[model samples]
Target: MNIQTTLKLCSVAALAVALSACVRVSTDSGDNAAAQADAAAETLQDAAAGAEPADAFLARLARHCGQAFEGRIIANEPRSPEPHAFEGKTLVMHVRGCDDPTRELRVPFHVGDNHSRTWILTRTDSGLRLKHDHRLEDGSDDPTTMYGGDTATAGTAQRQEFPVDQASIDTFNARDGLSVSVTNVWAMEIDPGQRFLYELSRPQDDLNPQGRLFQVEFDLTRPVDLPPTPWGY
Candidate 1:
């Protein structure tokens, strides 16, 4: 072959090789990006599928951490023989103690000037647990403290019901005039940016045929000023 022809052929061959390399690199990069996207999608789907209802409920409640809400007694039924402490009282709930929100949340339930009650929600291996930590003015535990229960089922993200556990039942049995609370079923509901509900119910029984129901609803749309720290922390 002539030198000029050989040189021209060599140039053409180099150009073709360069074009091939560029096409291959572009295709490889696109394939890698697609693979990465698919992996991320799968990971999200898996996480969603594995998530439990209690997890979603906790997450929803955690959104209100560091805030406070005003509540009112919506229903106090059956009319207790004695006067109710919540009647004509200003109710406030402070959501705090959320350093490890995924595991625990402490919400102080203030009635008028009383800061003796706290609702503690904790995550468990099986589901979630709710405990009423009652304290005296001097930061001492009350005789009827820690009287709540764990969730019995996989409730919705907006609500969870806790049936009185054996420990609470025993506590009730040990106290006078508290036997009526042995069959209590407490439920908490949250509608983000709308409202929250705390409910207590008892089925009809021989001791009290009328049963019982008490519910307090909080307005989440307007966060109130942070209340005092709960007694006994």
Candidate 2:
């Protein structure tokens, strides 16, 4: 009977030890599973953040969005006035479309109170491009206009602008009467004291029936004192 009792006690101890080992294994498995779930959730969140193409482009555009800048127009082809000048013209850019950005964002400009224009910029594999998306008063692409000209002749190292394509021309006109092209870009610079500057030349032949040559200097710096609205009211 003593031998039997000793054997029985040993058996009971073994079973208890085995049960504890199983419990430990189960707890470890639960912890690992929880950790894996958390990792997967984080991965999913990262994907969601990058899914929107517009958001990415908007983030890029916002970097240069809110700053006030003066626009200078250069006419490659001159028509009337010997040369047209936009030196004294005033314009404003209101960038409020970031709420829901797209691959392209259209922001409106108000000349104090005159509905000036809507500039649309799009993201492309090459770089950021102006949509040149415009509509005619009749909502059509004017058959007589060209969106942009070829920039390949400028220089290989200078990728400031791309060659204009025929496809882009009809797309903007048919969808909207407005389309624009960057003819030439020169002297792009920015100052740490909140100033940005660039020179742009546009072919006025597209807009006016008679060719026009024009260029204007841009003040990219923020406005300190915009003149009061034209004294009409």
Candidate 3:
């Protein structure tokens, strides 16, 4: 080839190599950025995965942890005979154990002098769960224990509702012959420095004239001294 043409060809080859090198550098930079972004996203997810939607509500309840409050039943009727036993007694609920990630809270309810019941709230993958843990004074499990329900929605931060689950229904039916309890719904509400309420209701039907709803409210503004240890640890 001619000298001029050969020199021109050499210049073209050098330019091509330089362009290829630039392209490789640009690709590597993009890949590194993408990797950094992915790592950041994964770290955020790890922090959030340990939290539940009902975390705010759980925190509110936890605020009262290690404290006790007096309560009184405001609604009666359509309730199991068990509630009547709490009447004419000093009703107290002591917010006991609290573990956020596992989402478990143990609040022992003291009726008059009987410390046989505990209200347990737990966090599930879907939402939340509430269970009534009853025990004898000697700490033996009650035959009709662990009957409660799971949350049906992403309830507000101040409140959450739990519609009776099948397990609760079966327990009620087997223990008390209350097959109708399958339609029961329970809810808990907390307003910091105001009041905390626990409620139960059933769907309206021929048996229930207007559907049975029972609620008990505690004075949150006042935290009384802690009571004796609950029946079960």
Candidate 4:
């Protein structure tokens, strides 16, 4: 072969090698980018799985904001001798006062024409808090108002238990005939689109030999008309 021809062949060979290297580098970069994207997605999934249960519970309950549900007493064990106040009364729950639902939610519980009770759920630094807000028809706070407790454990998203806190125990002690409530343990459960439950229980003791068990279930499938604004809003 001629010298110029040989030189041209060598140039072509080097050019081909350089082009192949460029192609390989481009493919490797694309593969690396895809791997990083996959890793990022997996990290996000793991984070969601490890989220706090109390936070998940709050998020689930917030879905019912601005809605009302009808409820009935499902169980009242060791039944009262006389007709209980909840007997033959219409029960309704209005999920309202949700300016920032994740932070706080107020649920008004209406019985017949009475609008004196509200259940306040709040997300605190540690976990969730449940407070009973009782008021009179005149919009005045009841002597037994603001009595409830806080979640002591990392309950599930569907259920949470609130054992009577020291504050609530103090309130019960101050009130006459309310000493039996010192052992109260309140619980709430939700099955999204199905049912919601509010429960109260107390262990057997001298004051309450039979203890206490009361539960009310609300149907979430069918929301009722909004009830009147609760007393003391």
Best candidate (score: TM-score): 4
lDDT of 3 by residue, 1-233 (tens): 99999999999999999999878767755645554454455435535665454776786677678889999999987666474876888989999887553478888888878888899999888888999999988999988889999999988666899999988888877865677677889999986656789998988886566788888899976789899998978
- Give candidates' CA RMSD values in order: 14.2, 19.0, 15.9, 14.5
Model 1 agreement with the true structure over 1-233: per-residue lDDT tens digits: 99999999999999999999878767755645554454455446436777677887777778789999999988988988898989888999988878998899889999999999999999999899999999999999998999999998988777899999999999999999999899999999986666789999999998669998999999887788898888887
* Each prediction's whole-model lDDT (CA): 0.88, 0.43, 0.81, 0.87
Off by over 4 Å in 4: 1-49
Backbone N/Cα/C clashes per model = 0, 18, 0, 0
TM-score of 1: 0.78
Better of 1 and 2 by lDDT: 1
TM-score of 4: 0.79
User: lDDT: which is higher, 2 or 4?
Assistant: 4
Residue lDDT tens for model 4, 1-233 = 99999999999999999999878767755645554454455446435788677877776677789999999999898987898898899999988978998789899999999899999999988889999999998899999989899999988777899999999999999999999999999999976666789999999999999999999999887889999999986
Off by over 4 Å in 1: 1-50
**10 residues in a row with least lDDT, candidate 4:** 37-46
TM-score for each model = 0.78, 0.39, 0.72, 0.79
